[model samples]
Target chain A: MNLFSIFGLGGNSHGVRKTESSGKEEHFTDTYILALVHKLRTPLNAARWALDSVIHGDDTGKEAQREILNEGYNKIISAINTVNEILKAAEMDSKDGVDLKKEKLNLCDIVDDILKTLGYLIKRNEIKLEYGDKCNPTIIFGDREMLDLSLTNLFDNAFRYSPKGNVFVALTREGGMAKLVIKDDGIGIDKEDMSHLYEKFHRGKNAKVVDPNENGVGLYATKKIIEMHGGKIEVDSELNKGTTVEVDLPID
Target chain B: MADFTNKRILLVEDDNFLSELLSKKLMESKANVMRAADGEEAITMVKANPKFDLILLDLMLPKVGGFEVMEAINADPKIAGTPIIILSNLGQKNDVEKGVSLGAKKFLVKAILSLDEIVDAVAEIIK
Candidate 1:
């Protein structure tokens, strides 16, 4: 849908040019809207990037500062989650439904690409970041960007809470649906937190370890993105042990 | 070498407050700063003084847009190679990609960055 024609008020309305129908005004206005959207999203993207950096322990062996690095990473993630919630509230139509441009995508390849871009984080944390080869070029129908962002948030979370443990990402096919599994041996959530995991601003007890004002919204946004793609997310975890998040997405 | 110290920079932005604040910051770097609230004035000013070392552009402008200004500058030989860095609030992957492909050297999102960061980016790019 051309958001410009739909969201923009007509020329008859206020400062808009009605007589000069060059579409130049419309085009320029559309560009401005696009720019504004990007402007607003950049900070969120930066926060995600910054968090990923801290979680994956991208800095040199500054073992003494690991605690600060870990806390900073978690705080950045919290900030990104907060921004995502704000965007979700503002982009009304976008939140409820996602117009996923589905294509035949290889799940393994996609995960590889995401990890490669984020290699710095993986290497810095000394955490193992690898996917099972069984993924087998799975074809799925979903918006690539939405899928990537969801995966990024999940993997990022796994890496942050489990800095000293291995982070395993695996993909499996079952019952005609593809499942992406991200597991981590970090500070897993208590059973109590799982109930409100998908609720915006709901944070676990350990969330305060990162920031005092923690708004646990990352999983919520990730859940929305997944559901919008016609997928389901299930979490199985135990405090102090590990957590596993399984995303079941349709194969197109 | 072309001296960038006294050279003027054309900043085209719609927001008056930001325009003034940014101009003041850039001026502190010893560069004579000129303001164009819209694209038309930007184009006219560039045409008059093609010697500008840099063009700090905003993606959103009133009359003419940043891309249009870029097109105009790129079409002319005099200011063709002048460094053009996008100082915009638009930092989306696609938007930043488009600006760079259209000759913008760097794209900075305004909200996440401060005036000092902008000045530093300008200094580094111009240098």
Candidate 2:
């Protein structure tokens, strides 16, 4: 009946679910659930404070009140997006795999849309984004929504990790494949953390030190989505130096 | 209601909406408010103007972090004595202890406190 029961975190005997029989896996599940709660609280807190200001503050005019309301609305939308991502990741983890609606899509358009969504944070963090494309309208055959989610995950990491640094995103063609490169001169991964980069709920030590609220599900879901599309993902990183991620997909 | 006429306060928070709301509230109390969007910027501003009446710091930041910023300030004799009130989402016992040990006069969790309460805390501190 409670929220934790819905996630099988409650103490109810029937709520208990079986895992891979590894203590590490169970630990990961617990950590992931906690992180999800923390992540959800962030946007909700913002929305709450916005509403609080509108209700209590007296000096604000109608214009300012409207702006605060809009901010609260956006924060609620952000919380919904986080929940949707959790659902998408869970669906992808299912044995049947995620259902994808295949279509002809342009990688450039997808990249542009994600960038537009992140433009505010990019500017606030003082990150300079350099987007280059050797092949215009690099087309690929895939599910637009799934690819959008995957690429957005990658792009989000690139921008989020890089503060006051440059993010260079390049797109090119390599024979029968389309290559997308996202490089950031931000806090990079350590050697030990590199091996488990794609593991569910595994966050790099340095990454956690920088942003502690990260849930560590983005890369795991991203890899799954990419693999389902018959694509490949590669990452190269050096601690404090930077990170570069290369994703290759079959060209249309 | 507390008045903070000409009292200078530096608010170190990254969230645009939250920062704007807090800043507006502090300004309504007549406190002169300076804002920092990241830990690095917070440190820079603190060093540049060490005469601030109080500081409101957020732990999770972009380039640097809140605790590190406090450390940097504590290292410098000129800014070491500046009063700081940590306003963060991290409210674990260890986090609060660390903030207190780092010379934070008060540790306030953002989620639990209302704007009026935060302003009141600030006013009480600097009064």
Candidate 3:
């Protein structure tokens, strides 16, 4: 899906150009609508980031502060759960239901956003995650919502499988592309497991043993979204050593 | 050396929640903050005041949009050079690039940005 067309950009994405058709006004409305969708989702993630930081023991000095933070943490979970339920219900109506409104975004910022949202989960699992560098930059053109879901599921998989070891994430800008490598020293996937790992509802033989609640569908979802953005996911693993899933996306 | 303690900033926004949050954060950084709730007021403030070090703007507003405000302010030669940072939830790629071409120093998406991150960006911009 060329979002430049949807937003009436006439093909050029990095710079502005007038639309060939007489629908300039219509394009403006569509741009505003796309922006409106983003605005609707801003606070949900922002609140989660702020609350997760506090709940993950940024400060536990005062009783009231702890109480309020805990309440906020729980509330964000309920809100997220409700939103997920709604999205899942929507998904049932259409296989590819989630709207993919493409846009150019910083790869690092998206990763950091998801990490903040999962701050509490990471803290609970005792996973040491790293990805930001002041000097390095990684920017990509893709749908923020779809990419958010893809990266969330990817990080979720990495965190759940690896309980003791660090789950390191790094964004490498090289060869005119950005590579997000999520490597974990968890129960590594068997070679056979890699065969159907990206198939819907297919999980490794040992995945259930580590986390019974594993949906077995997250990787497939992540792969689909990544593919939609003209990216590829490759998994390298040893049965006992670790697993690394590298997502390479073209940079704009 | 851009010390925010003595620098004035114009924060143009309509959302009270975000306005208060960002305003409070910028103030804590010791920046003297002025505010405009709409693009019309922002234009006036940008034109009337020449001492502002930076202008933080939001797109959606009650009276006018941020782009118009940008155009109105940038049209004036005296304040045209003042860097304007777009702190918005308008996360579309086109929106960001458009803002940049219109003379935005940086386009920071609010949804994926923490207040601390934004404050850091402001500090960097001031420097």
Candidate 4:
């Protein structure tokens, strides 16, 4: 099962609904451009203001100055990453898909690396994570970097949306497929937004309320990557309750 | 040069980093800064304390938007008199016109203006 089948997107998964009239398409294009502008502008604004404060401020200690400079650097890095994500998405949207370096990978190692990278966020948000005991060393044939990016997006969403909440992750092999499940007791999706979950630049209303800074590109890119790996991803969510995302990949 | 001694200002911004930087800059100008991270809190604070010398508002807020917060403030005669300068990244023509029509004293795009310039704008309006 592909992303189109899972999300009911029906051939136009890139957010342009070909069935709509020309006027609606134009509106969609305008809205998309506006959203993109807002996304790119935010980090730039933050970085500029941080540097300006450092330059124009008076009686600031060295420690505080260093902290502000670090923040500015991080924002610039974030902006660069956003640009890279946009470029990757554009590449995937083209007729020629993204070029991936395929290799044999252990899913467990990828999960561990991602979790280690997210250690700071977990500590800061006070999230309780449950994993490893139920996880088996599942092997898969795919691009390690692409799979890493996709899984990181999912795990990041679970952590970002569910601060101070509980997350349960499990991976096991079932027949010819390796199944991975991530469940978070975070703000779940509204029923109205379920159908549009995988659409490009589409953010749920509740998600916007929780984290307005999100550019809504994570899931879109994640779905495309998963599809390229010949994997199936499914999500089950209820408003205010929690979310459960299951990904199934063919075993090597 | 921008002296806003004892002047009270309300800052309505959702981004934590930008809010902290702006608040510090405003405080450096000798202004008392009060912050509301979302539009709902901004409206509530404005209604409760309507004597602010100026308000710095961001448009794309969480619970409610900046424009709606301004509308709510305008609905109340006491708070409506307070000056508002919009601090937002959205600088489209329609957005500017809407902010102006909603009684914002100045519409400053965050990405375009420096922190000092924003504080200067606040001081200019309040003075």
Highest TM-score scorer: 4
On the 0 to 100 scale, the lDDT of residue A165 in model 4 is 98
Interface RMSD of each: 15.3, 2.2, 15.4, 1.1
Can you write out model 2's per-residue Cα lDDT over B1-127, one digit (the tens) per residue? 7799988999999877789889988888888999998898999999898578999999988678999999999999998978999998777788899999999999998878889999888977898
Global CA lDDT computed for model 3: 0.70
Q: What is the lDDT of residue B123 in candidate 3?
A: 88
Error of 3 at B47 (Å): 80
Candidate 1 Cα errors over 4 Å, as ranges: A1-89, A92-96, A133-135, A210-216, B1-127
Better of 1 and 2 by DockQ: 2
The reply for model 3, stretches above 4 Å from the true place, is A1-99, B1-127
TM-score of 3: 0.45
Per-candidate DockQ versus the true complex?
0.03, 0.41, 0.08, 0.78
Number of the top-ranking candidate, with DockQ as the measure = 4
Runs of candidate 2 with Cα error greater than 4 angstroms are A1-34, A125-139, A162-175, A184-188, A203-216, A238-242, B47-51, B70-83, B101-105
Determine the backbone clash count of candidate 2.
0
User: Given candidate 4, what's the lDDT at residue A113?
Assistant: 93
Candidate 4 chain A, run of 10 with poorest lDDT = A1-10
Candidates sorted by DockQ, best first? 4, 2, 3, 1
Question: Candidate 1 or 3, higher DockQ?
Answer: 3
Q: lDDT winner among the candidates?
A: 4
Evaluated on CA atoms against the true complex, candidate 4 attains a DockQ of: 0.78
lDDT of 2 at A95: 48
Q: For model 3, how does the per-residue alpha-carbon lDDT over A42-135 read when each residue is reduced to its tens digit?
A: 5454464446445442354587555545554564664565456335323522434556678889987888888888886688778877655552
Candidate 2 lDDT: 0.83
